[model samples]
Target: MNRLQKLTALDTRFFYWCNDLHRDLGLAPVSRFVSRLGDGVLYLLVGLGFALWEREQGVIFLQVGLMAFALELPLYLILKNTIRRDRPCDRLSGFRAVIKPSDKFSFPSGHAAAAFLFATIMSAFYPPLAPFVFILAGLIGLSRVLLGVHYPSDIAAGALLGVCSAVVALHLWELI
Candidate 1:
């Protein structure tokens, strides 16, 4: 197989490996919950909490976080629509995702992007929360793979996109 084909094969193998863990361990429920958390609500709540309770730092975080998401959303939408890569569950026969995906294409997982964006912005403002937020961001990405709604590469791309967006936002806001 060519390099691209080999990468695709690896992605499929990794997906099955994660799926086996999800199935063998009965982790669907937990995966669903974690995935749901990455659905943008938590990010809003985090921003709101900071804005309402944290004073100046909170306001700055809110602004930077909002900017990061604003940048990420359009890029994410464009890439997903342009690439139009099929989800593993959609492409692979005899496989159905544990939960319905939010959209059709899955080149870059929106959930993973948003989660990592939130984690990056949160870490920039509240350094103490870095470990927890980054860990949660990673879990959100893993949850997408476990639920079979996204390929591992999709998650990786989304994560890289997210971190880049946040870094840009931070720089724009003069916070980094």
Candidate 2:
């Protein structure tokens, strides 16, 4: 088979492996929690809380995180629509998603993008939190695949976009 075809096949297998492993390990509750965190509520509150305590730092955090999301969201949508990839649970036979998705397309997972975007921004403001935040973000991305809503490649793409969006947002904030 062609290289792209081979890659797709591998990605499918990886999805099944992650999904089954999560189910088998009985980590459904944890997976669900991480999935919800990617919804952006937790990050928003954290940023707002920081703002309440420290005006300057908080404003920077909020601005950077929001800007990153604003950038990530549209780019994610364009990629999703352009790719038109079907979610694993939707396309693969007998596969079921642990959580309901917000939308149909699933090339670059929105959850992964949001989680990574916040993680990147937070890391920028507080370098010491880099390891913790990134680990949490990584878990959120893995949760997407484990929940059977996204492929490994989808998570990768989302993470790449998120990091890039954060850099762009920071640069733009500096210019402004």
Candidate 3:
């Protein structure tokens, strides 16, 4: 087998292990909750709430929210379509996923990307909260892999993409 085939085989085996763990824990509801919390809608609402409660902190929250959305959109809509990586559940025979995924490529998980992007952006604004935010992002990323929707590599790439996007956004913000 070629390199790509070998990777796929490995991913398939990993997915089975993930699937077994997911079934053992019966963590469907919790995973769904985490995934939803990592979504843009919650971020927007949280940003708005922060803005209302603490004016200065709210501004930072809003900026981070905007940066996250801006970064996520291109990756979700444009780059994913261009790259077209298949989800583990879709490609692997024994793959099992409790929660259904949307019609998006799985190379770089949107949830992972969004979670990390928000984590990094929030960390820049509130250093103390950085560890918590990063932990949350890491859980969300792991959930993607554990739920059989993504490979370990996919989550890693998504995290890298998120960090890069946040850095670029912060730099541009500084310039402006």
Top of the candidates by lDDT: 1
Name the best candidate (by TM-score): 1
Against the reference, the lDDT scores of all candidates come to: 0.93, 0.90, 0.79
lDDT string for model 2 (77-158, tens) is 9999999999998999987898888889898988888888888899889999999999999999998898888999999999
- Indicate the residue-level lDDT of 114 in model 1: 92
**Residue 77's C-alpha lDDT in candidate 2?**
90
lDDT of 1 at 120: 91
Q: Give the Cα-based TM-score of candidate 1 against the true structure.
A: 0.98
lDDT of 3 by residue, 103-144 (tens): 756877888888888888888887999999999999898888
Task: Write one digit per residue (lDDT tens) for candidate 1, span 1-176.
Answer: 89999999999999999999899999999999999999888889879998999889899889899899999999999999999999999999999999888889999999889989999999988899999999999999999999999999999999999999999999998845
State the displacement of the C-alpha of residue 165, model 1, in Å, after optimal TM-score superposition. Answer: 0.3
Q: Comparing candidate 1 with candidate 2, which one achieves the higher lDDT?
A: 1
RMSD of 1: 1.3
Please give each candidate's TM-score. Answer: 0.98, 0.97, 0.88
